[model samples]
Target: MSEPESVKDLVVVDLGVGMPSAIVAKFLREMGATVWRVAPPAGDPFESIYPAYTSWHSGSRMATPDHLDELLARADVCLIGGEDHPGLEWSFEGAALIAANPRLVVLQIAGYARGFEQRAAVDLLVQARVGLAFEIFSDRPVNFACPLPTYGAAIQGLLGVGAALVERERSGRGQLVETSLQQGAGMFLSCLWMSIEDTQSVNMRNPPKDVWAPIVRCADGQYVFFVPRYNGMDKVFAAFGIDKSIGDTAKKGYFGDIDLFQRYATKFTHEELLRACWAADVAAEKVLGPGECWDDEQVRVNGTIVTEVDGRRRVGTPLTMRAVQPNSGAPRTSLPSAPEDAAPLAGVRILDFGAMVAGAYGSKLLADLGADVIKVEPLAGDIMRTASYPNFVVSNQGKRSLHLDAKAPESMDVVRRLCATANAASHNFRVGSAGRIKLDPASLRGYRPDIVAVQCFSYGASGPRAMNAGLDPLMQAYCGQAVRAGGRDNAPLWYRNLYIDYATGAIGAIAMLFGIREQLCHGNAVEAETSLLEAGLFLMSELIQCADGSFSGGPPLDYDRTGFHCTECLYQTKDGWVAIAARSDDMAARLVNVLHLQGFPENSRSWGDSERQKIAERIRSRTTHELLQQLEAADVWCEKCNENGWQSLLDDPTARAANLIVETRDPNVGALITVGPLVSFSRSRLDANRPMSVPTGGVDTREILGELGYSSTEIDNLAARKVVA
Candidate 1:
């Protein structure tokens, strides 16, 4: 089968009900694919939930559902909102979609993949069930302001679709791809989760507070944040004539005298501190309010935020692609697709120079897809390899590792040799670091013009903050998620956790897919990249603006630790807490009937103190499960907030059976249970038993060297010279 000419040659049908399906459809359209939105007569019932949806769906091709079957039969890809559409809640729906077009890639977006598939899967409930309530919000239970699970799930679902499409070029067949809001939450915490025998990992709220960056107020009472891992912060202080001691505090992750640092920081306004930090090469950003980031200069220049023709704001697509038409007689991108029993990416090879989680996790996913990934580590390995072995293991599992001192002149030879056999290369090294070592995309293109290359940056590769260190916390502070998540208190708090890091890694994986698709379908090699800031903005895409600078987000969460009102908020039961998501009027009426209340007042997003107290009292009267059963029976979305024990989620019987979570045995760790790839392929099989390969780092240096035809003496001499390990 010949490959389609390009994304422009393909037809994508979006039958999804909400943003999760829309996000993927938008991606395909941006990539030049013909996209059509097929919806119910009511269009999208919950489209009003996001104010930005007005702009997000601007000019979208809305096709009548009367021809939905014909559209699916002729489409190259189909996106179904498995979570929002009641019709897609069962396997029969997915099976029917795939059976409609055996050559179509059917991507079903849902709230949960397994055990709770039949439940109402609201993003807030998914986050609550996944234990994000205590970690993202304050220590006490608070409704996380962002719809994070759906945002992340949208990207994960896109990844699943891209990978399946790439594999289709080889197999000439389609597969069912599934992802959920629950899995989206899992993406944020995938690498951090660990399981061995009966023990499971827990959340890391106090993870490393200093690593959160100092959230300091400016002279005008506005807030700013600095990169925690950056070492040049003291230089910024000295440039501003502040005490270098306070700067040293920042360099040490604000270890000592935080108040002193805050005092010094307050001496400068956002412009003043930002200018000084730029001059000193210290990465910093102002803590923006919801929708304020739509005007950021850095994001503006990098096109992270763009303006539609009508001047409405929109987040840029995750992929920034550069297409290069192949030279005459160049080979095609399609390789022999793995057989029916093999993983989708069985024949692909990737050379990964990703250092930390931002760098490592995406390739970790590609590796999970059955690609052959070779980790090109510095002599000491990744900077964070020792920070947490479990993290490193999760991020670099199943890959061979080679240690090289890129600074050594001899190392270039080894790198070039590996490039000859590699289809792609990835890295998250500091800005200009790759160029200094001649490993940048342009340099590698000279070695393999058809290679798929991707780079991950803290900021983007251009614009004002491009040189910033890879700081996920600072991104949260900068993009306004921290402030939004902070809710009524509005301290702009951020956790030292996976906000943009893991998602950026996932985005990087998508960038890789973009390159690979270009090579396969377009007969071109592509260069694609994204940043922590850009990824964060994508996560916060709903916080947008209109032509007149009017904010698009709904009111900020004012009544902290709860939902918009009494009917929608979480309830403390006699046992523990259960979250209630009765945002719709119907659900709210059902909830009122169940609780025996006259219902909330007509004109308030927040409950008065006394009203809240009365609601809490009524909720606490029943056990959590009893209330949950009553609520579920009434068709109200409710979920119990879980702790880290939810980490062994892959061990759930339905999940394991679906291959959404697979059981693997590692020689070093006996039985290891890990999340199967977030996406599942119905026609293809994964090497589930070997999901994890090493107990520690890969010891494949000699083996890899031998494969490259390096002789024993030469390998020994290189090792002796400290050039290779």
Candidate 2:
């Protein structure tokens, strides 16, 4: 994957609203693609909804709608909000546009599942409908502060576009790509399905118990997210007069109780406690928003976390694509080609040694898209299995599992043999861990000289905190997401959504797809990388630097604390809750007129506590159905947050109609219901119905070795020697 200096040869037309479509265009623009936006000015990301994000992309512009045909003629990809935003001059029809440009890839982004699309494409509603609130906490659906589903949709969509481009190189024809907030939300919602298999475990996990409540309050009143999971943390806890109940390792392969120091934590100041935690190898960091983390030494030095894009500090691109250096006299191998009517990556093979959240999500996505991803694991099995069984199955499903211990030299030889049959590889090893096992990307080249390797981790590849252990919660605390919604003097509010963890996986997949494109188009092997920190920033791309040395965007929770602004916020109705995203004055006017709102101020800034209370009272008197009808009729975005979300999944009729929800029956696990691959292609299938292989645990060892030409006696000898589990 030769990542040449520029992607100036590619052109993209963004005709969508909000972050999902905008972020995709921004990435291509950052990579030198000619991006043109011809959207309704009010909702256009380039103009109003997120000027803070577009301001930095000076090269991107909002072209006139009349020029859609011209842009489509030469555009490699055209992103649209939905069927609603069709071209006024020509109907902006997907079929018509693709017909005009046979090579153009059209991507449609919506809020609901595919067949159920006309439901207002609002992020909050989608998050609510998917039972996000319940998934993280109680059994009832509740409202979420941020549009996390939107971010998840964007990254998945980004991968979709990239994969389409790679597939186009093979079939020489373009296709229609479809994705939605439901599909995006489903990525992290994988755990919901776990209840069907292991109800007890799902009942036990109550994710994200607070707005950093488990946080240690230092003497100075600053908050530190401390998870005392170090090897000798139990002794350190005793020394500090903290709780010593979590003796030895805190839950091996998972986090320990964070409240162990809650009672005694205030004895030390923030810095003092931080230093102590670091010295003791305990995971701890001061809680800060995305903007505050911008100045951290590790963040600034690595430059990707709060990167300077055109002199403005912004959450830059998540992917780092570099040209691979071929050996002195060898040529890169030609990339594999997908068979006609097959999935986008049909013939592509991946040796995935990745496990846990980020790695599992990314490679599992690759597995769904027809990549022969071999889930290579050590004999001890993936620790995620021990930490959360349901979580493990959701991420590990749809792929073949093999147990090959990387530590054993003989096992490593078998790993090398598998690598020779793979064109791509990935891992989430902590910094420097892979090299020791001879599984690093550079080391992989010795087996498949032209392999495209994707390596992911916390922090950066080479920073002071590079070797430090980190997780989803720490990322939220460090990069500001945890503080985005809570802290009503609560100090540090954490989100229940594992959005950053999920997005990191999608970004990793994006990097992998980009490398695949490089391999397919230019016959080049590449080294691509992404991180949780980078993915977290990308989710909050609204945060940006301004000329006055001040940053703008990523507003805190509103007065109601349910959304950012009054007009674009959540409200409780007679029967349920409804989310509204009528940000622009035009849409707000429609909302007021439709709801027969009286004494409503034109500016949300004018709505103080009393005014908000009055409006809330009025809305609370009306049924959700009445409000949805009146609001949507006037073009105002609104949706009744899903109240029966749990049961809804049992028979998601719309998802089934759209083929977004499918089933696979395993010999041992019976029938497994899942939120299948989000991206849908008109020309090819994504193999969403593929059954998950049981956790390998050496079940496939003999077959895998036999495929590599190992004799039965040789395999018996290897097993006898304990090389292959």
Candidate 3:
């Protein structure tokens, strides 16, 4: 398939700084949009330092701020980075821009949701606030070596832009769309924040005990990670010359005892164990550094990592849609316009067969866009409903629920009927499970030839471990993420949050959108697939590249002891803590003046060890408030560390003004305050006043069946037969 013409006429003005903004532009460019990137007269600070900029900013035109008015005159969308960043003052004039061009979609990115919008924040500080820092290193807060928060925020920003464009198609007017690092982090880690009936039953502070842990050291002193399935454990044990029955007993007795398992695992070399596991058909892999992933055969063959014509290597977006065929001469169908006051996906219908985080979150994203989502549940309902109430509520909000038994023949007919009415359907069942339930693409297509089907799994559909059951932690370990972030000495720690699951959901949503675009361009359905493994790769892409055919993992020379680059790190102040990022020369100079570092050079590398220590000491002598005031006056990037947790945002002026938080009463959980929608359109913003409620499974089954042309008598018979709940 060729690139769709839908975005060909769209002109995007990218005035944001850094990789996040560049990422949004890259997605637009991929969809054939014309992006004109407006930088300062002096150019981006990272232009000469970061190779990611080179990769993300490719295929775009560059302009200076002087052309802002001219660019806005023709732009359909404008992406603005944080307000305090150098050369981004123009982005603050959203009201003026909309007055001039009422149809312009202005997307602003910020560090915090509201009150702290003007404060300087980098990826490190954002990660710290969201618990990533503390999660990665148990002893103290340490930022990931890569900028994951930035990427997360960027993906949300991209979704905002896409939704706004869809809204514009109907309203013919553009609006302001805003997303922040804090908000994105919350969404990315939704599963972790979930509340259950008995919180004590599941401990977020420690690793899960049921699944076998993946980390093991080899005789060669290298770490290897693998998820050994229970059924395959016998084979793995046999290959290692251990009695299967004895090994099973040991596993059952010492399930959560890491020390005991390690003692047993060390009996064999890492290479030997990995070979045995692979031979036994268990899901296993040697832990690889970011750079080493570039050479992995699976990554290379799947085009997960690509080498550009300019010789720069970068990770590719996991979401893929076939291009429109050239010279086919098929007439393109224009998407129908939404009605006034309609949501972006007002007319779209989605079938939610998702369970847990990956599947349900994808459907929730669509539901937020105003799609009519019918959540199909089993007779007993979604397992998460009982396991985690918060997870069930957040994932199924704004959708109607129906219950059916997939094993019943009559229920399969109901699923087919529903498929005939849905524009798309998504599920995260293991490979072949969808076929067993008659909801796979082949079966769904039999009902609706043009239905878009998205299937997500632990691994992808074609991998050797395609059918293996996996979770976020297991995938993280297997994909080298845990080892990379935890450093060499520590046992590979699972990310504190469900980063993989949320990322997979976001990617799945993108895939569904692309599939919809394909159907609009060509009258055919598309099957979209993504995996937790792919999400992990995309998150760690910034560090996954090779230049000299060699691979190693270590902190850069500029790394600070506080978990950020020297120019951007957390520091102690007299009264409290502050996070600073004096990335540019100008900002560095301002930082020097504010901190009274008399003899220190702007380049941190130029300072002697003693001099650097002295500078830190001097800064530590001042109060956090005083330093923040001084830094703001000097235009240096900095913010006081927010250790008060997410509740602090409740009183934030910017967050309130931007509608970043909302209060609603839930039938089961009572009054609650939750993060609001990531994007806000001038006309089609979600109704913050609407109570978010998830009805019990089968609550609407009878109504749904009635709508499907089944009479009361037929519905009764189906229910009596255990076909429909």
TM agreement with the true structure for every prediction: 0.89, 0.90, 0.84
Residue-wise C-alpha lDDT for candidate 3, range 169-275, written one tens digit per residue: 55678887777776676675454433334344332232332334546676677776655453535655554556554534434532233444456667778878777
**Segments of candidate 1 deviating more than 4 angstroms:** 1-5, 85-92, 115-117, 136-139, 195-213, 230-260, 263-282, 564-566, 599-614, 644-651, 654-674, 694-698
Q: Roughly what TM-score does model 1 have, to 2 decimal places?
A: 0.89
**Pairing residues by index, what is the TM-score of model 3?**
0.84
lDDT of 2 by residue, 231-275 (tens): 446645753566555464354323444554665777888898888
Ranking by TM-score: 2, 1, 3
Worst window of 10 by summed lDDT in candidate 2: 82-91
Candidate 2 vs 3: which has more TM-score: 2
Model 1 C-alpha lDDT per residue in residues 307-404, reported as the tens digit of each score: 78887777767557677665777766666645775787878888998887889888888887788889999888786655654566667777888888
Candidate 2 residue spans exceeding 4 A from truth: 5-8, 39-46, 61-70, 82-91, 133-143, 198-213, 228-236, 243-260, 305-311, 328-339, 586-597, 604-608, 623-636
Which wins on lDDT, candidate 1 or candidate 2?
1
